[model samples]
Target: MSALFPALVAGSDRPALRLGADTLTYEELAEAAGALAVRIGGAGRVAVWATPTARTAVAVVAALLADVPAIPLNPRTGERELAHILGDSAPSVVLAGAEDVLPAGLAELPRIDVETTVTSFGPVPAAFAFAGGSDASESPALIVYTSGTTGPPKGVVLSSRAIAASLDALEEAWAWTADDVLVHALPLFHVHGLVLGVLGPLRRGGSVRHLGAFSTAGVARELGAGGGTMLFGVPTMYHRIADALADDPALVRALAEARLLVSGSAALPVHDHERITAATGRTVIERYGMTETLMNTSVPLGSHPRPGSVGLPLRGVELRLVEEDGTEMRAYDGESVGEIQVRGPNLFSAYLNRPDATAAAFDGDWFRTGDVAVREPDGYVRIVGRKATDLIKSGGYKIGAGEIENALLDHPAVREAAVTGAPDPDLGERIVAWVVPADAEKPPTAEELADHVAGLLAPHKRPRTVHFLRALPRNDMGKLLKKALPEALHG
Candidate 1:
C-alpha cells in the first residue's frame, strides 16, 4: 500500500544519479517526478520505452506515484514485437524516447510527447482515488519478462513487497552501504540492471554511474575516474574487461579498486573467474537469480571464493532441491543433486495473464527454478545445468552443459563456449560446442576440443562436433541462446 517514491523521500536530499554530463539529486528528481506525475494525471498503465537516462528514471517513478502501471520496454525491440506488447498491455498512455522508433500505427494512440517538458501541472488525486484494485502488499507492481531465447517470454509479476524483500536481502548479502557507489553498465529493462543495479543502490541512498550500454574502454575509464566502489556485470563484460586489461596495465589496476565485483544472470565459468581475479585482485562474487526472483544467493564477501559454487541462500530466503516428480531432495548431505527450488519474500507473485504457467512455477510455496544444481555439505550451491539446455542426452547418457562448458573454457585456446545438443540420426542427439577463439583465426579444431573434453570427461560426455563461430548468440544478460546457435553456425 505504500508508495516507493514517498517512502524514499522521507529521509534526506542526496545525489541519486550521476549520468554523463548530468547529476540528479533526490530532491530534484522527486520534484521533477511529482510534477510529471501531475501532468500525466489519472490511472492506467503507461509503457515507458527509453534508455537509462535521468528522464526515464523520473518518468517511471512518476507513473508509479500517479497510480499507473509502468511498463518499461527496450527501444530497440522490433516493430512486430512492439505491436504485440502494445496490443497486449493496452496502456492508457505511452511515453516514448525522443529518438525512439515506434511502430507505424502509434500516432493514433493516447500518447504524450515525453521529451516535452511539463512544468505547471495539476495535482494527482489522492492514492485512494485510483479504481482498478486495492493497493495491497501483494498487488502486482512490475512485470518483467524472460529473455525468450527458447520459447515465448512469460511476464513475471512482481509486487512492491517482493522488490523490497529482494533489496533487503541484497543490503545484507552484498554489504551495500550508503557509502557505496555503484558502477552500473547493464540496461534498465532487465531485473539485474533495474532491480539490483539501480533499485538496490537507490534504496540504500547510494548512487550509480550509468552507461548507455556495455563498453570495455568506457567502463574501464569509469572505474578509474568515478568514485565507484562496487561493479556488477555479466561474464561477457568480465571477459571484455580482462581482454582490455591485458593491453593496459593501468586499466587492470583501476579494476582492482572495486571493493566488490558481482557476476550473475548466467553462470560465470571457472576460468573466467580465475582470470578476472588474477588481473584485478578482486574475486568475482557469483550470485544465483532469475527474472522471477531478482536475487536469492551470493558468494560471501570474506569467504574463499569457490570456482563453480554460487555460495549460499541470502537472508530472508529459503531454498530446497527437488526431484522431477516434486519430491524434495535431501540437501544437508554432500551428494544430493536436484532442481533448485526457492520460497521467499523476494519471489515474484505470478506470470502476467499466465495462470497456468504461474501455477506451474510453484511447488506448494517453493518456486521451481528450472536449473539443476547441487548443494554441498557447507551449504554452497553449484548450478550443474539448466533443464532446457544443459540436460543433454546423447547415446543414452545425460550430460550437463555447465560441466562441458566449464571444461572447454579451461582450455588455453578457448575464450568463450556454448554447448548444445545438435540433431542426430542414431544417438537421438549429439553434443555440439560453438566457441569463440581467443585468437581470432586460431580456434581449436573439433578433434582438439574433443580431446580436451576426453582428458576430463567420459567418452559419452565428449562433444561430437566443435563449431568455430565468430561469436555465440547471447542475450542481454549474457546467457547463451542455444536455439539461435544452430542457425548462426550451420547456415
Candidate 2:
C-alpha cells in the first residue's frame, strides 16, 4: 500500500545503484525515473529492453512510478520468441538504452531511449509522486514471460502488491537492511536477477553493484574486504566460483569476507556447495521460487545452511506439500515427496490472456508450483526435482532425479549429470542417466557409474543406462533443460 521504494521517495543522497562505471545516488535515480514516468504515464503498457544496464533499471523504475505495466524483453531472445512476447503483451512503447540495437519485432513500437529521455527531461512532475494507497497496490506492475517449455511463453502478470510483499518478506528473511550493498552479475530479464537482485536492494534502501558481465575477477574486486557485503548468484555462477577457488585465493578471501552468499534459479549441486564452503568457509544459501510466485522460500539469515535444502517458507507465505491426488501431506519425515503448493500475497495476478492456463495452475487459493520436494520435520524443504521431468518412476519406486544427480556429481569421474525416466517393459520406467564425464578419453563406464549411484543411494535409484555427453543443455539462468536432452539414445 505504501511506496514500493521508500528510500527513493524520501530523497536520500546515498549511492543507490551501480552498473559498471556508472553510479546513481538515490536522489539522481528518483529524479530520473520521475521525469521519465511523466512522459510515459498514460501508456497502457511499456516494454523495457532488459539489458544489464542502468538504463534498463531506470526505465522499469519509471514504469512502476507511472503505474504502467512494464514487460522486460530479454535481449538474447530469438526473433520467434520476441515476436510471441510482443504480440502477447502488445505494449504501446519500447524503452531501451540509447545504443541498443533492437530486433525487427520491436521496430514498429514507439521507442523511448531511456538515457536520452532521462538526460533531456525537465524537473520531475508533481503528478509523478508515489501513490501511497491500497488501491494502487494491486495495479499491474510487470508482465514477465515464462520460459515456454510446454507451449508459447505465457505472460505472468505481477502486481505492485506482489512485488512489495516478496521484497519485504526477503528483507525479513535475509536480515537485509539499508547498510547491505548487494553484488551480482545475473541478467536483468528474470526474477532472480531483476526482481531480487535489483528491486530487492532498491526496496530495502540498499545499494547494488551489477557486474556487467560475471567473472571471478569481477566478483573478487567488488566483494573484496571493503566492498559489497552480499553476493547473489545462480548455481552456474557458484559452480564456476567453486571450480576457481583452488586457483584464486583472492576470490576465496572475498567470499569469506562477504556477509551472505545466496544461490537460486537452479539447484546448486551439493558437491559444489561443499567445495565453496571448504575453500572460503562461507556457505551459499539457496532459495526457491518461480515467475508466477516472486519468492516462496529462502534459507533464513541466522539458520545453519543445509547443503541441499532451500529452507523454510518466507514470511506471509503459506506452503504445503500435496500428493498426486491433491491431498496435502502433513508429515515431514524428509521422505514424503509431493508437489509444492503455496498461497501468498507474493503470487502473480494471472497468466495474461490465458484464463484457462491460469485456472489450471491453481487449486482453491494455492498455486501448484509443479516442483516436487521433501520436507524435514524441522520445516526445511529439500527440492528433489520437477514433478513432470525429474520424478522418475522406476522399479515401483518414485525416485527424485535431483538426489541421484547430486549423488552422481559426488563421483570423481562425473563432471555433469542429469536423470530422466525412459519406458521399460518390466519396470514401467527405467532410470536413465545423461552424464558429462570429467575426462573425455577415459570416461567412466556405465556399469561403474550405475554401481557408484547404487552405493550412494538404493539400487532402484541407480541408472539403468548411462548416456555420455560432452555437455548438458542449460538455459540463460543455468537451469538444465531435461526435455531438451537427446531422445534417440539406445542402450
Candidate 3:
C-alpha cells in the first residue's frame, strides 16, 4: 500500500545508483523513472532487456512505479529459450537501452528505448506522484523465467509485496541500512542480481555500484579504502576473489574492510570459504533461495559464522524439513536430511500460465523448494543438494552429492568436483565423481580419490567411479548443470 522505495518519493540528492562512471542521485533517478512510468502506465506488461547497466535498472524501476509487471529478458539467453519466454509472458512492449541490438524474437514487439524515453519526457509534472500507484499488494510486479532445466522455462510471477517483504527481511538479517553502499557485478536478469542486488538498495534508501562486468580489480577498486561497504556475488565470483587473494594484497585489504560479503545461487565450497577467510579474516556468508521464493534463509549478522550452513530462516518465513512421505521432520540432529518447504510473504504468486505446475509446486501453504538440506540443532540449515539431481540413493543409503563434492574438493589434487548417481547392477545406484584435477598431467588416481572420500566421509559415500574432466558444466550463476555433464563428458 506504500511506495516500495520511500526514498524516491521523499526525494534526496544523495547518490542512488552507479554503473561504471555513470552515477544517478535519488532525485535524478526518481525524475527519470517517474517520467518513463507515465508513458507506459496502462500497459499490460513490459519486457526489460536486462543488461548490466543503469538504463536497465531505470526501466525496471519505472515498470514497478507504473504498476505494470516487468519481465527481465536475459541478454545471453538462447534464441529458443528467449522465444519461449516472450510467448509465455506476452509483454506489451520491450524496454531497452538506446543502442541495444535486440534479438529477432523481440523485434515483433513495440520497443521503448529507456534512455530516450527518460530524456524526452523530461521532469515529471507536479501532479505525477509515486503514492504506491493504484495496484494491490498481490498484483504481479515481475515475471522472471526459470532456467528451464526440467522443461521450458516457466515464468515465476512475483508481487510487489513479495519484493518488499524479501528486501525488508534481508535488511534486518544483514544489518543493511541507508549508510551501506552495495557493490556487485552480477547479471541483471535473475532474482539474485535484479531483485536483491538492485531493488534491495533502492528500498533501503542506500546506494548500489554495478561493476558493469565482474573483475577482481574492479572489486578491489570499489571496495578499496573509502568505497562500498558491502559486496554481493555468486560462488564463481567469490571463487575468483579467493584465487586472487593470494597475489593481490589490495584485494585482501578491500575484502577485509568490507562490512559484509555474501555468496549465493549455489553453495560456496568450504575449501574456498576457508581460503578467503584465512586470507582476509572475513567469513563469507551464504544464503539459500530459489526463483519461486525470493529469500528463505540467510546467516543473520552477529551470529557466529557457520561455514557450510545457509544460516536460519529469515523473518516472517516459516521453514520446515519434510520426509519423503510429506510429513514434517522434527529432528535437527545435523544428519537427517529432508526437503525444504517454506511458507512466506516473500513467495511468487504463480507460474505464468501453468496452473498444473503451479499447483504441484505447493503443499497447501508451504511451497516445496525441491532442495534437500539438513538442519542443525540451533536451526541453521545446511543444504545437502537438490532432491532430484543431488540426492543419490546408493546401496540403500540416501547420500547427498554436495557433501561428497565438498569432500573431494578438500583433497589437494582435486580442483573442481561434481558428484552424481548412476544406475548400477549391484547397488540401486552407485556414487560417481566427475572431477577436474589441479594438475592435468598428474591427476589423482581413481582409487586414491575414492579412498580419499571414504576416509573423509564413509565407505558408502565414496565414489565407485571417478571420471577426470577438463571442467564441470556450469550455468551463468556458477551452479553445476548436472544434467548437462553426461552430454559434456560424452561429447
* TM-score for each of the candidates: 0.90, 0.97, 0.97
State the lDDT of candidate 3 residue by residue for 129-164, as single tens digits. 444332236888899999999999999999988998
Q: Model 1 segments beyond 4 Å from truth?
A: 1-7, 11-13, 99-101, 114-136, 331-336, 394-397, 422-429, 457-459
lDDT of each: 0.74, 0.89, 0.89
Backbone clash numbers for all candidates listed? 0, 0, 0
Cα lDDT tens digits, model 2, 1-491, are 46788787776779899986678888788878887888898899999999899998889888888889999999999999999999999999999987899999999999988862245554444455456212247888989999998899999999988988898898889899999999999999898899999988998899999999999999999999548999999988998999999999999999999989999988899899999989998889999999999999999886776989999999999999998999999989988889999999999999999999999999999999999999999999999999999988887788889999999999999989999999999999999999989998999999999999999888889999899988888889898988878843331
Error of 2 at 7 (Å): 0.7
Task: Please report how far candidate 1 places residue 59 from its true position, in Å.
Answer: 1.7
Candidate 1, position 95, lDDT: 78
lDDT at 250, model 2: 94
